[model samples]
Target: MAQNLVLIAGATGQIGASVARHVMDRSGWDLVGLSRRVQQHVPCPMLAVDLLDAEDCRRKLGGMQGVTHVVYAARYDHAGGELESVDINLQMLSNLLTAVKDRPDLRHIHVVHGTKYYGHNAGPGPVPYRENAPRSPRPVFYYAQQDFLIQQQGGQAWDWSISRPHTFCDLVLDEPRSITLLVAIYASMLKELGLPLRFPGTQLAFKSRTQFTWLPMLARSIEWMITDRTCANQAFNVVNGDAERWSALWPAIADYFDMACGDPEPERLARFPESHSDIWCDMVSLHGLRPSELSTVAQWAYGDYVFSPEWDVVSSMDKAREHGLTESIDTRQMWRDSFDFYRSHKIIP
Candidate 1:
């Protein structure tokens, strides 16, 4: 039997890390991960390569033999706005494609996208965004990357797949940009401060429906896309087959921390977490938790985006279900499992 080697880019990131871990646990698959920095707890072989530099990518990735799959989860965040973000992200993908274009054994390439493809990031859009929804008018890198993949696949042996997920939930600890970690840190801080676990956004956001994609679920969807022929050359929305309202779920979250749920306290989370740095420090000492600064653990800007939303962000998972990927998870149970995992790792009290 031939060996299957899967290359996972951005292996330390939320989506990429989950994919790598999932692939590692399976049989008859070899895993190779790429990141700018060396990850400590990853279970696969990792290569330190900067995807932005074309020459560096060629030098490092050109020689990897027998790579059958590529999961492109690498991303570059630019603060200068959409145009700059599009340019840098496009260049990075182009560099990776140019380096790997010659691999004969490559059978599939999967790109990870998000709800921003449907204009959720800019403002409200139609509910339950299907795979065929019209592209957003704003400049986005998802279109560019998909177009690049289509162009590259012309007369080539490899096919491509894309998965769009929303508000990833994973077990990464102390990751500043992870919404789950931010919520956990925020709740822990509130507990230490003797404050109620309040719905810290507008009333609309508290009541508005939202969706999430568990990291492992997204990973499994990617794997199904890679292995299932029916999923080739198609984009699908992969979410936890349910929608939730924070107004109803806030109490469960508050209960997890043994705090009372208070009324909505609409405030910019970007500025909120910083004010409680001293409280976070005191909590770390009181709980005998990991020694790390609050800023390194909580991302207030991301929290604000997750909590202060005015519109519902729900995507249709019917496409994925129709294709025989029937995995689903309960949103509340997913949160409980994640919180337990964090406590087991000593990330929160």
Candidate 2:
């Protein structure tokens, strides 16, 4: 119905690449993907440009020049080794916004943010965060990118929206991209060794009440925001709409992997209560290389988070529903899809 030209930054990232692919599927929309390198297997039109450079990014991001919309997924992905990731994100954000300033055809902007903006870095509060909640005072540098958007949109000249999705998992290809999926893979390894598939060693804060969002759903939602004016100037929470206990979710995962969860005796568990480890401890144990081979049964257990006894806050998308967004993905189905995808790609070794 409409001619659209779209630009996406961070096109090679786990989320960004998926978003790019989805947008490319649009009939009347032209998608330009910006990345540092032209990786093999990319289907969309890509421009090799450094987003950190304001001038180059402006020249390269075609959508800014009478182009339809811009989606900023760019971030420092050096495995979190760059301690100044927040600062880097904020600067790139400021540059990108300035580069596209005052473009006539720019209709909307959709930025992907996680629940980390809800002060997950601080701690979960009972606030049940709404889209309009006050920016966190202890804002991480990443939040600044969002604040910049709010400031730009406050002028009311362009269509703008933000999506705060919760606990999304990807193809389990890396450490930082999909942490929950990383945990799932670890749990799979545990089941291989006849270990308990349930939360081991510690009780988590959220007690494993978590929801997952699928890749296709997240990507398409961004596309929806771009084409629909009704989505303007609002914030939305993306949830998988399914919640499950941390303990019970393990069996579902076991079924997906076709692996058996070893039954731990209740009395024996009571005696060796310290057998399972928190997320961090389990990682250190596994990577510590205590055993040369996988011959010994590693008594340690792996779970959702390194820190336990904290509440895993559930995000609600009720407000988004009020604004004409009704679609969502199922958690269990989404996780199984990701598992199958990773196995198919041989991504998890």
Candidate 3:
């Protein structure tokens, strides 16, 4: 067997964190972590290097021997909103690909592709986006990013795989990504207020769509794509095998918080409580949400896109399943796990 030296860029991130740990537990790969701040020792050996500098990335990575796989999960976290995502993500990916262009020992490249790629904000995508479907320029980043990979994949020697996942849940010691997180916290607040029965939205936009994957499950899929021969050079959408609505999820969160909730009316959320804002810190001193600090309650709430059954994201798992990877996690349970962990870790305060 060939020495499976896997190089993990951005190992400190949520997905990257679990990927390293999962590889350690399930496989025999020698891991190399790349990050700007090597503050805490991760689960694997690491190299502290800035990947933004193309030459630095290439030289340091080029000098490394036996790196059979590379997982590029690192990107700029400093940018506000989605403004800098495209340039930052595409540039970093392009540089990394350029760095390893001449290396033949590498067998797989697993890139952490986000959701915006499927459709633009409040998009009309073909529900359950298939890998073979038409590529949209909406994400702005997807086109360029895909171009880089397609250009590389054309070569007979280089092997690559794209893992497009909906919002990742239950990250390692971090907040969940999908709007569901906000839904849980908001429901908790409503419960604390002793509201009546929770109301399901009558609107028709989001009712028909659902897709999500827990962090661990996604990490497993990414690992399979990197190591398994069947997954080579294929693009796959990975999600747990379950679905639900905010109304269905609110009760669980309300129960956990020991509060009562009724049908959410326009009046209740009309005031736009300070707790619901993305910048929660600014509003904490004004309201008494019972927390010591203003933890953004709406982080999980899909921003400006809140009509229940109004909008959605449905990622297809067909490609990955075809590649012999069909592991699944319960969506509701996963969200509950993330909420429990966030509360325990004091991340939601």
Candidate maximizing lDDT: 1
Each model's lDDT: 0.86, 0.63, 0.66
lDDT of 2 at 243: 57
- lDDT string for model 1 (91-195, tens) is 988898889878989899999998889988788889989999999999889999999999998998889999999998877765677777777888888887799
TM-score of each: 0.95, 0.77, 0.81
Which has the better lDDT: candidate 1, or candidate 2?
1
Residues 19-41, candidate 2, lDDT per residue (tens digit)? 87787777888887878786655
Clashes of 2: 5
Model 2 / residue 294 / CA error / Å: 12
Alpha-carbon shift of residue 304 in model 1 (angstroms): 0.7
Off by over 4 Å in 1: 79-84
Number of the predicted model whose TM-score against the real structure is largest: 1
Please give the ranking of all candidate structures by TM-score, highest first, separated by commas.
1, 3, 2
Ranking by lDDT: 1, 3, 2
lDDT of 3 by residue, 1-349 (tens): 4368787888988778878888887646678788877857487777877777888887788777776788978777752235446787788888877777667787778888766666634456676678777766554666677778878777646588878777566645333344555565555444444565354344343244556668788888888788777777677887785656655655565666666645545332323454444444432333433343323334333433344335555667776777798798887677777667666655453
**Collision count for each candidate, in order:** 0, 5, 14
Model 1 scores a C-alpha lDDT of: 0.86
- Greater TM-score among 1 and 3 belongs to 1
Q: What is the lDDT of residue 131 in candidate 1?
A: 92
